[model samples]
Target: MKEKKRILLSLFRKKSNMFLLGILFFLLFFMLVSVSIYNTSRDTISAIERTYGTSFSIGLTPDKNDMNQWEDRAIEGMDSPVRTYIGPNVDEAMVRRITEEVEGITDYEAGSRADVMLYEYELVPGYHAWSYNYFTTHEHHLPYDPEETKNMMYITYTYHTRNSCHFDQFYNGAFRLTQGRHITPDDAFKCIISENFAKRNHLKLGDTLKIDLHSLNVRAKYPIESLGSVETEIVGFFELTYQQTVTQYTEEIDILENWVITDNEAGRALDEIIGRPYYLSASQFFVENPAELDEVMEQVRQLDWIDWKYYELVKDDGLYSQAVKPLRTLKIIMAVCLVVIVTSGVLLLMLVILHSMKRRKREAGILMSLGITGKEIRKQFLGEHLALGLTAFFFALIVSLAVTPGIGNQIYGAVNKGGEQKVYTEKEIEAAIARGENSKVAEMSRNQRTGVEPPKELTTRVEVKTALLVFAMMLLIVYYSVNEAIKKTLKLEPIRVLSMIE
Candidate 1:
């Protein structure tokens, strides 16, 4: 036992061996720490992707130009995208049919959208009697020239009728009512108006307001002067709950800020006034398991009620895909790196252990001769390497504290396949700024972005848990490397080993 202790001390005292092993230990420790950081970051990012993108939606647009494609026969776009439409009142019935037949469809909703020129007199108790177009011209700032907006028969707000999910300002948590309640199907002729519109016109709940309603498509067929008026009762007034993405410099013109919501019955009532066409709204199919999206879409295309020639299915998961791209890419690279590091670590350290055993052959044989068993000899070597590994682990942790952030950035950029950085040309930005266009700036800048959302830089710390995990992993690797050396050492005869040393 005493000799074994002496042998262990002497092996460590050899400065050259300790120095080389220290470098190796440092590198091994760095690789372990980097692996931890990237793994944690990757897992965190993956969770976020799953949370936000769990529901994938399918949208079918209507193709009104082709009227003859509605037959039950093999639809032209069955294998491809076909524009589709719903019966005038079958929106809810169709939603029920899809949710029942599609095995993976978790939720279903339908919606109708139409821009209405809404003109109301005495909208507020005491306000100026100025023309309604003044607000559209000055405040609303419709993305149209004045002449195009001229002879418009109504004061406008985009009217919406939600069937299943209300992805509107209120339902999406963009706003909450300051007074009154959200309009529901049970309520007749009820509406929800934005706070900005309420403030601009000083309107309130339960106010019976009459608005001249006209559809642009209808106006093309009939004279604008012939548009009819519809009356509605406001049930709710909602205030902006949070700051929204600015699409234009004119804040007052934001659609959500001045939007209006009505139940389907009331909206449809307005649509049918004065021989207006009953608009066929689109349905959004939601699948809880996005992986089954393709299967669900196939089933939907096979439905007898749907006409494929006019209805094209669109995926609504692009945001999720883009958001998950960078992190997923990095995770794959990290996994590959982990494999290479571990395999190479095993090979490289095996070489080092083999060389170390050559120098200590005589000592190992002496210990075996002196009644120290082979297991004890192996244990002695393992103990020595373990101490070295622990020492190296601390040093690597200290160094990583200073360099991890910069290293993380490099790893992110590398795995991003040369697309890590957002590409925005100065000329384009300047042109957008000069054009006084907010939306154009986003459009121009997004021409090239890291196809995936660039992951936030990982912040690393030399915490106790991380230290313990890395230390344990290092010891495991060291034990594996030394196992080969032990086999070679135990096979050596004392006389032969001594002769070789001499």
Candidate 2:
């Protein structure tokens, strides 16, 4: 053991050998730290990608001739048709077909708003004046009498869907369930109301809430004479996370406070009673992988069953793209760096060991002449590298612990700065809109976002397991290089080795 220790110590005493081996050790240590940081950064980006998925909204395409005009439809019992400006809505069959047949589609939800009246409760006040004052104040000409439409804006409306879980509002943090559960496909005649709405109405879970569907008759806008009434049980209550500030033109019907959410069964039941067209106001479909969204959309567009003239698919990936663009770019950069560093590290270490071994031929011959076995000489070389490597690893670990976090945080900070760092509230959104930014951002703010914002900064720390992994990898490289180098030298006779010039 003492002799082995002496041989290992003597190996490092040679300045040439020590310098080369020291450089190799430090290089290997740096490679290890780089790999560790790459892994941590890659994981952080992957998590964000998973959180924000790519999706698209399907809606009706507008007609060219309908520019700046509201489409009017005739009521059953009116002298003239009321101006019921309805946008093109997605067909239920089309939504089902696209979601079922499309390979990349992971989830979908269909939403529609119904004009309805609560049996006993009035709406939470909106920005618009009372319906009576609204007509007198705005000078709005309509086929319907102002007296008959006086209570029209005071009734409750429903944001109805089959599965509330997949709705963008609920998927994002905009709407948070305060009590009870979200209405699922399995739920029947179940509904969710805003916490403020529930509190104001003194309603709770399991309470029966009756809503009367509005009549489209021009003279009977507030009565339930046409479509009839449907009873629903309160299943959930949600609280808005941010203040829903009303802009100057915000109307009574546009306010969220008076809106209720109902399940698909309730919607179907309303359909059976109202006998209205089966059209969805909006439909969103999420892709399983963001990278494949374009291919999936192409496949959807090629379907023969869909009529392209009336329907259009608009990509709704603003939030996902904004959040993931920087992360993905960083991920790709780290991956490329990891590959380059690890590949070069292996090659450089091997070349250094082989070159150093060429100089050790005379030393090996003399050691063999002194009765040192080839195996013993090999062990000495292995011991020397292992000692230097371990020492370098310890120093590298200390420096990496102090350095990697700053590097990681710098990368994350740059990414955060490039993307939407914070979710803008309605007030902030209004400010952004006033700045002549994309008006679409305001609509997006009211709808979609990830449940949690991407982390503000990334933190990387070298763990014990990561150190062990680096140690194991270094050990394997050292062992392989030393064994291969010694094997070549041991192939020759000791006299031949001793006679050869260094």
Candidate 3:
């Protein structure tokens, strides 16, 4: 034990050796942390891109009536004729039939909307005037409430609708429930609500709300008719980050809230109310590989039901590219930084070893004179440096692990502040259900909603394989540096080693 203590004391005595080892170790640790953080950031950004997908909107010029003849011609020319031109009034049955005939269609949802009134029960006791005002006036001014001034216990009303193409494309991808289940195919009359809407309305899951539809003669002060009353049970509520909430209102009509989400079943019901077909203005197609995108687009173009002039096939690859371009650029920068770090680490280690060799020359000569084998003397020197390198490496790794997460979070937050907060809501779904006026409101909501947020941060657990890899690298570097130091320090002529100076 005394001998071991002496050896250790001797090893650390050289300040240059200590510094060299620390630098190399720190470099490796920092590199590992940087790589890990960068990968995590890239993965997060990619996830956000995936959620948005490739979004493209289709606008028909002069409406579907103008393109009816063209659609008929395309369908008539097909080998197996199928109805291809889906307009704003297309029904669910038509969409289902088309899906059966299309080979490439994995899934689809039809978009439709109708103006419907949202009805909630207001129970105000005769004795509680304050409670009556609180429920009728204060709550009514909220965006979801249409009757803000009336004191007769008004239940705020808003519209709901569905955008068929948007629903089909983003159904499982972008829409996720924060508190409740999604509006499924079975939920024809059911609806989900946004967190904001639910909070404003004081609503919860399993609560039934009434919806009333308006007739075409909306201008008639009392022209709105309860064409059909549907009781929608609140199935889900989603949190809307500030980024997801729409801040601007461009249309002539004002919307209650900026966030909305819904399924196709509600859209179908609205279609029955309106005489025309409804199609989502936008569509998105996801491909397993980017290379296959062009082929998929080609297939969509050839479909008789699709109007190339009015609609366009969107590829997810473009969206992914746009989202990650900045990240990829950052990765390149990090790679350059890695190179600089490695170069500096190697140079610093080389200098320290060279200095040690120079300083230990006399000691080496005395050992040689005492008949110590040059190889054994060299082995001790190598061992000491290896020990120093290892010590520094471990210290650096500890520091890096603690620091990288914060650094990653800050970088992500700065670049993606606006994208992280917007969420979808059921009011938007209801707006989607209402065609014309309600449909316009839904579009306004989409436009005004907060920009999408960056993806959630990914936590990285250090893997055993990574630890092993780091260890191997450190060992290899230490071996090379120490071996080189040994050969230079020994400096003995093999033939003349017999002479003894001590």
Candidate 4:
């Protein structure tokens, strides 16, 4: 034990050895921190991707002759369809057929709705006038009647109903369940509300709402009448926060309050009640493997009933790619950091070893006189540096475990805060109109619907593989530096060293 102590003291006493050990410790520390950061970033990117299912939209073009012109009327007074005439409208059979023929296709659904009035509830007194104006222009125009205007000025207002059709494949894909249940195939009169929409009208699960459809006849005294009523049992809700704020840039939209989701059964029911041709909305095909998307789309285009000129195939590739790009970027950055750190550490060790060799010229001369072989000297130096490198790496591993969680928390906070802007849903806008409380519905939609629980802090474990890798790298660097130092110090002849001392 005493001899071992003496050797340790002698080894550390060399200034160059001490400097080299310090550099190794710092190198290990930096590398560990960098790796932790990379891992945390990757996890964050993964979470975002998983929440938003990978999907893209296909745009349908209308014939130029069908475009509505406001030749003699104000832009607001011009009666035009929100969307120009596209295809004959997508149907459930077409959506299912496309999915069946495509390999790796998972699920598919489609929805369609015609113009209807969403009633608003009530609004605060201060902003009521502006709210009235907004709904009148953007939603449906409210007719002026001297006697009836006072009665209609209540909190609830009706806006023209826009038609929409949607088909969802399952609960797991692009849609995540936040609250209750998803709109299953069995759900006919049921609908899912957005978080933003729910908050705006103080709506909860199991609420029945009414939508009014207006006939185009100008002489009708009561322009609005209940077309169909939806008994919504909110099975689940979601934060369109990311989608609305990041993707659409429509910060004013409230998802839950404006948008409504119902399955095909309810759609068929609505068509029967309203007595209008339920226009086919957009059809979607969900696929498990993105690589097969192109082939599947081609087959869909070839279907006899599909209108080739008006219809286009849409895939979820763009959304998926965007979700994964961050993770890929983190991987690349980590690799570059690792290379730079290791190379710089090796160079630093070499410089320290070279300096030590110059300082230890006399020690080498004395050792030669004492009959130690150059090879033995080299072995001892290698052992000493190897031990120091291992110690530094172990310390770094300890420090990293404590540091990673704090970094992860900060990242989470930043993402959540950045997503706080209002996210409008078609239901929320409709709800505001239905309730006749359209005062700044956009501003009220920013609240998170599902209230996702905070993620647990990551407990970073020093992975055995990572530790082993670090150890091996440290050993290699120390071995090369110490071996070179020994070779230079011992190049002098033993006889020449002895003569110099005389």
Candidate with best TM-score: 1
What's the true lDDT of residue 180 in model 3? 73
The reply for model 1, stretches above 4 Å from the true place, is 3-8, 16-21, 58-67, 70-90, 100-106, 121-148, 151-190, 205-213, 219-226, 229-255, 274-282, 285-315, 336-347, 394-472, 500-502
- Candidate 2 pairs with clashing backbones: none
Preferred candidate (lDDT higher): 1 or 2: 2
Estimate, for each residue in 174-212, the C-alpha lDDT of model 2 and write its tens digit.
688889998876778889988888888888899988877
Give RMSD (Å) of candidate 3 vs. truth.
10.8
Instruction: Give a tens-digit lDDT track for model 4, residues 1-502.
Output: 2334534865768666667768988898777766665665566555644543433334466556654521232223345534334335556665666667655556665666544334454322223334445555574655653333222222222111111122231222333446766666556566665566567678777876544333321213432344444333455564442343321212322222345565556556556664645555555555554445666666666678666676676664443454345345555666688789978888887888777766666666766777777876666656667777877887777876677567545544544343333456657766776887756554544443332222334334445666676777777777877777667457878776555542
- How close to the true structure is residue 69 of candidate 2, measured as C-alpha lDDT? 39
State the C-alpha lDDT per candidate. 0.60, 0.71, 0.52, 0.54
lDDT: the better of candidates 1 and 3: 1
Residue pairs in candidate 1 whose N, alpha carbon or C atoms collide under 3 angstroms: 82-310, 82-311, 82-312, 83-310, 83-311, 84-310, 84-311, 118-155
Task: Show the lowest summed lDDT stretch of 10 residues, model 2.
Answer: 217-226
Model 1 Cα lDDT, one tens digit per residue, 9-82: 76668765676566566666667656766666666676655544444343444455656534333333244443
Angstrom error of the Cα, residue 488, model 4: value is 6.1
Q: By lDDT, who's the top model here?
A: 2
* Tens digits of per-residue lDDT for model 3, 440-459: 54454453322342345446
TM-scores for the candidates:
0.68, 0.63, 0.56, 0.63
- Point out the higher-scoring one by TM-score: 3 or 4: 4
Error of 4 at 408 (Å): 4.9
Give the Å shift of residue 223 in candidate 4.
Answer: 5.1
